[model samples]
Target chain A: MTPIELRCCGQGGQGVIMTGMVVGKAAAIYEDRHATLVQSFGPEARGSTCSAQVMISDAPVPFPYVRHADILVAFSQSAYDKFVAELKPGATLIYESDLLSLDNRLPQGVVARGIGATRIATEVLGRRIVTNMVMLGFLVKQTGIVSKEAAIEALRTLVPPGTSAFNIKAFETGYQQPPE
Target chain B: MTKREAQPLRTGLHFMNGNEACAEGAIAAGCRFVAGYPITPSTEVVEHLARRFPRIGGMFIQMEDEIASSICFQGAVWAGHKAMTVTSGPGLSLMMEHIGFAAMTETPSVFINVQRAGPSTGLPTAAAQGDIMQVRWGSHGDYAIIALCPSSPQECFDLTIEAFNLAERYRCPTFLMMDETVGHMMGKVRIPDAADLTVEPRRNTTRAPGDYQPYATYDGSDVPEMTRAGDGHAIHVTGLTHNEKGYPDMSFAVHDALVRRLQRKVHTHTSELFRLEADGLDDADVVVVAFGITAGIAAYAVTQARALGRRVGLLRLITLWPFDEARIRTLTANARAVIVAEMNLGQVCLQVSRAVQGRIPVHHIGNPGGPVIEPEEILAAIEGAAT
Candidate 1:
């Protein structure tokens, strides 16, 4: 009964879809965990609003979705609004500072944290959507559902041959962010 | 958060998708030619082999559409080579006519449909367990379908091998009812060495190649080995009703004998082809029955329910068609209630209702829009049955 319900939310152009795929795949292939990755798309695949969910567990994970999340990652203000209600009282919520607004009250039971993901993306990594991978970095730091080495290996296999350097750097920048 | 860890490593693993594993499995099972189209979820089945074929001296052809994709392979199969084609729901629709033709022609071929959302375009990337009945009934007239459904990536790899074997052994078209989740989802697929696999070759029944009739029935098996064009076998195959001698027949004798043999080859030999799973039935009050991705979830629900002092068990279907009627009859004999869940709107539920003959009430849970059914929801259904 591992924490198998994972919901990831981000606006258009963010790599929310990729994050869900990596997490779902890592849970299933690397961890030998049962996993289901589900995503909804907008007008355009790359630049439209999108969200993804991954269910991972040692036991067979039923269905491909969750009524409540064990973990939630939001990269924008809209993401928080759309996904906040799905959180259980004690679930973990990670939000990016530059693109996210923390003013909204979380449900009485959930834990909320601010991760400066977009700032790190634009300043440290010099990109925006890499914020999605940065959120993944923090997720692994928070849950350890997948080892950094395993994620990297999954990235190597998932990402094309040439883009690994930029992705690895973006991921590490988020990995080192101080937990709030 | 600590490094997410689990039980000790199982050592051997290949980080691959179900479609890729299917192709590798086909290769391992000695399939030499593949024809398929690029339909979402199913596209990977051809994609993996497309890259693998030429490298290993096999043939991979991306046909114009699923109709050609399926029919083309029948010719390859007739050429005395093992062949297969993969597609999703809509493509399978295009293939039904040809599938029946293959049945009438007695050409051995395998059709792998990674089922998607139904009656139309449906969901492109979503997972649904529909198409159970469509695969059984879409093709016209009375014929038999030997269908196998795999629950995991490893099974996806292994069952593709089984699909080919059954195709050749029965000399009828076989099917792999793969759905989206299992097709594209990556998992720990163990690639067993090729040498370790037991492969079957195409059965050949040619009597000097000059006087060979393609539709002759072999004793006991009721299926005649197929001989192809230019082998001088004068192979005659048409979708129209034909007699054992490969000629048209509307007379009762040929019609009755030909149709019965097609059904008998599968139903009479059901034990040799059908596969299923049963748990908690030894002394259970409520049982969860599911197939494809839903089976994985139901398995977990059984564990949770049993831990909560509930008598819950699971029955997972690995072979979808040729309905395992005997197993269903025994499992439902003393059960308090049975819940059958799939991704579609009660296709298999109809089959289950017929099998039990209304002895027990069968509840239905379906998501027609390509969504996976949740475990907690299934758990509730199991609990609901108890009270």
Candidate 2:
């Protein structure tokens, strides 16, 4: 892909930054491409809005900030509301269907899909904390920005050692979900 | 010894942020002492060092304040250890006095200033290149310093090693001027085996106790060989103007010689320390000059400007200090204008203007601090400068 900018936004404790890091690592380390991730958060430790911007490209990813996201994956209602307008026209947006409601204000010509990422993680994976992983899996599957094996390898390195198997299962489940 | 003689390093492609990579670079460079207090954007450098240093037989101290931290590393340096301190703008401001002290006593140490927005306590979470002048001139002195700016995580790792080498080579404080964006950005860093990297060892005096002069240069070299504080060499170090015997001379001749040597050491080595990445400069009408994170954005802007059939080039300053005045003069001589892009209110622009000597206009694209200067803004500046 020609330099694609991706942004993931959620609450502070929702692993937004980790998701961005994993995707960036998958492309940069495993896929032999270039990626840069920049994270932003506030003083509030747990519930504050947090976002991670990742740019993946065949060439060096300079200008690290996401000016207008080519792809946005948001996991909270507040995050979705805050960042939806920053999407480029005809950009792809993926949000948690169970956590966020779409408004009429999404930019024109935007292609958006919603997945019940939190629900799937809580019910199928038995852990709601891996919702970010599920969303990341869904993002990789839909966009094909990174290979599934590459994403799984990144998870193996990033996630806590003892819980890798469980997180990988959540990722696979989310990867199989049909986009809506 | 060269890097080829060191132990094997974790040499492979790894994904890490600039701060974490800096910690790894320090370890690979054989830096054993890190003293720093936690601050926004720069705290990760200490955090990673804290976790890694202990396992590798190094020491990481979270000092009570920036002042204590800055001096703490100098103490380690005197005791024969490679040392560094990490901080952001306000903390760097607090360490300025000690940085001067490091220069005065010829302490070989490194200071990693992951710059954020600030004169005092400005935006702690945002990126800024505002500390460019501060790192150079904040300390009260007529002394020169070696300051390196890294625009990526890989350079963060590579140049941290270079910072240590330069500090030891010149026996003065070296600055790694990073910004919030590069500090937090994650990317692939290919760390080679330690045996393959070039690491400079600290130069210690081989003179006998009676013959050693802590500030002496009997060999005519500007840098005196440093003897450890407790190395049985009757060495005395003080911030005051001292003679070759390391005793305070309080005389005009001694002070002039001491101060001039301190500045001359870095000045004479400008050819070795002044590093820049010049692209499209051989045939260009307008050139963009930038350092730190702004340099990365300027590169992209130069690419876009070139695509639009504009003869715009980029001169990315990896070494912000020592200015590279001769290269700047030659590059701007035939250009219509030069654009100095940075995250501050025209600090580097002043340097560019001085270097250009009014032969051409020097346009500045500056951001007070919050957001980065967009590539389009620089592209527009390139268009304006081209006209």
Alpha-carbon runs more than 4 Å astray in model 2: A44-46, A85-90, A103-110, B1-8
Ten residues in sequence with the least summed lDDT for candidate 2 chain B: B1-10
What is every candidate's C-alpha DockQ against the true complex, given to 2 decimals?
0.33, 0.71
Report lDDT (Cα) of residue A62, candidate 1: 45
Q: What's the TM-score of each model vs. the native?
A: 0.87, 0.95
Residue by residue across A4-101, what tens digits does model 2's lDDT show?
Answer: 88999988888888888889999999999999988884463367877998999898876788878999999899999889989999899999898889
Model 1, range A1-180, lDDT digits (tens) per residue?
664688888876778778877887777666676676656632534665567777777865445565688788887788888788888878888887667776556787777777888777877788775777787788787767678876766666677678888887777766777766
Candidate 2: deviation at residue B79, Å? Answer: 0.8
Best by lDDT: 2
| Residue B243 in candidate 1, Cα distance off native in Å | 4.5
